[model samples]
Target: MFFTPLSLLSGLSPEWQLVVWSLVVTVLISVPFFVRHFSMQAPHEVTPFPFLDLPRELRDIVYENLIQNPSYPPCTPSPKALSRFGWLLPQRPAPSTSNWVMLSNHQVYEEYMDLLCKQAKFTLTVDQKNAKERDIWPIRSETLKQIRKCDLRLVTTSKMLGAEDPRTMPKDWPLRDKICERLRGVQKAEDLNLHVRAIGDPLWNPLWVWYHASQAFKDSAKPCFQRITFSLDTWSPGENLLARNKEGQWEWRCRENHFVATDAGQYLIREFCSALYAECQDCPRR
Candidate 1:
């Protein structure tokens, strides 16, 4: 093999190989020590910004945690209802007090069924205009397009009873393909877990599911555990949701940013956690 020791280190003698290995191990072992020393050498100036509080490396983690990955899986959409209306669930769901919580972004994306369902939604859209942005719902990119292309009209809720409907699963798997592509796109990274939470029943009270999903995770946290959050923007009121200008564009209005349903988030988090633990114990964890 090209990587055989004799081939790879052709010039090295047995003694030199031992020395090189020792050096490699020594280098690995010293990294944390050197890092710690340098970190200690820096002044402990408290920046007003929380992002600033972290080291440059840590700061990046915070951004990826907060800004870079700024989306959550909407609740588990009703896949069972997919066939008749196609996958479109909500044109818009009104905000609710029950939809809020803190969840480890990691745990939620670990094949959490609810988040998986949102992923299913991304695949079924055919509107190419704002398709990517709209379908990525809850998760967003600054450049992401808006959700404008689908032709959803409210057929009465009873249509859900139809059995011939197609699943929200896109007949084509481009959405899933893109997710995989993005993952593979990150070069040389050894560990990566996308923490998309499923807001189950996206068509039906999404906020309620989101709040409960987060609550499930929170309720499971041990006292020793540190809590984390999904983006807080979901619960914030739009600036001008109530007003419309003569020019015909949605106006922006509110100054408050972020959800404040702490009690609700906590409650749903524990309850869902209990249910998930029980379900996963019996079957493979979704």
Candidate 2:
């Protein structure tokens, strides 16, 4: 028979009843704390994952699923960088979740970083302001060495726009020279993209002048690019900035051949076309 506390205490003396009630109250209060303390002390069990046991091929697939972004080769000056310029500037995207996942362990970190460096296409931006501070290659040489493809954006200052001939650019124009110097260190690349905005100036007008003035295309000895793509800004329809020749090499050509009927224009076009073929021939592809 279960006797309630009130019923049991009813038969006891006043002093005895008071002592029993006090004991009951103490037990009730202590029970929760006792349970909580033991719960805290008990070790949590973690389920083991056999990720490391997987084959290298399978692990690469997993790494690619995690880290390879669709909008890859994302623009730099990340959100953190923009914060320094005041809140008015548009916020850039944060690093992908894969970046944080790499921090899980040293093994994962090394493997993921290696894959990222080798496979991912990187955008290398060089501006006059940042070049002066010697901050062109934001990443280390070790990481840069693994890069296979690059989208190079060279932002020229307004003052540079005034130069009629890029070849005759003053000695003070060290920014372009500095960029070229840095590029010389890159051992190889599958594709090198030079943006129209970067090379677009009064000097590059008529397109033929690029072969004579641009150092990157002029120096065939460098032999770094397997394929060099120049993105052009054009309003004309059916105007292709590049076309594959009979020999399978990409060549720059103006669609409106009759438009450039002048003897000088035709000669310049021929020179540029010939130079393009030579540059492609010299660049070794692996």
Candidate 3:
């Protein structure tokens, strides 16, 4: 067997040994970095997507085509109707298409929402019977800020508004007040149409209710709307009564019923515009 001489390694000075070890350590540390630097390939070139670069009108058209109808959950039927029917009726189903690509990103979603607010007749139903802050949760604050038009539907029951009782007012008046406050805070809404539906005696007038509600919005310091329309929906009997006259001739009678803004409601709207003019006059010039 060949024996290596220990003298060869042992005879080296401590300085020489340190120098050799330092060189070895340096090579060991630098090799991996050099290998990585040379071995890494350049990132793959990204393909240019021109969809975002299109004109705003063309982009809007593209987004409109991509938007699918929102899948809204079925509203629960009234308890009285359910009890009368003895079973719950199935609600209309939403479309089955799974493509909601427009809602995939924030930018496209905003575009779609803006289109809906501007072009479509978006309806927000507020059930005054079950007055809840969450009722308005379907609308986002950002959307509210950008709203150019709004159609607000307020549904009230006899019990909700105390329509049956002439002497007592609604117990949930504060909730209605809160809802008006929220509407007042919408800083960009321009055209507002309010529809009130009451489920009680057809003779139960809603003029006072409409006036007060409109007044609440008009009195806001920073109202966002220029035009407001108020309309009320009341039950109208569809049948006509036929009676025999004294001369033995048949007579037909029908009651004329229509849904339109009452005199007081129109007056309140005029007052609202006047108030807005007054406020504008008081403002300091920009």
Off by over 4 Å in 1: 1-172, 200-276, 279-286
TM-score of each: 0.19, 0.55, 0.48
- TM-score, ranked from best to worst: 2, 3, 1
lDDT of 2 by residue, 30-82 (tens): 99999999999999998989988999889889888776622323455545555
- For candidate 3, the TM-score is 0.48
Tens digits of lDDT, candidate 1, 62-179: 3333321122332343556456675555533333222221243443333232322222212221122222552433343322222111111111111221212222212233433443
Model 1 / residue 131 / CA error / Å: 6.5
Q: How far is candidate 3 from the true structure (C-alpha RMSD, Å)?
A: 18.8
Residue ranges of candidate 2 with Cα displaced over 4 Å: 1-44, 69-93, 160-168, 171-173, 198-217, 226-250, 253-286
What local distance difference test score does each model get? 0.32, 0.55, 0.51
On lDDT, the leading prediction is: 2
Which whole-number lDDT from 0 to 100 does residue 166 have in model 2?
A: 45
RMSD of each: 25.2, 9.6, 18.8
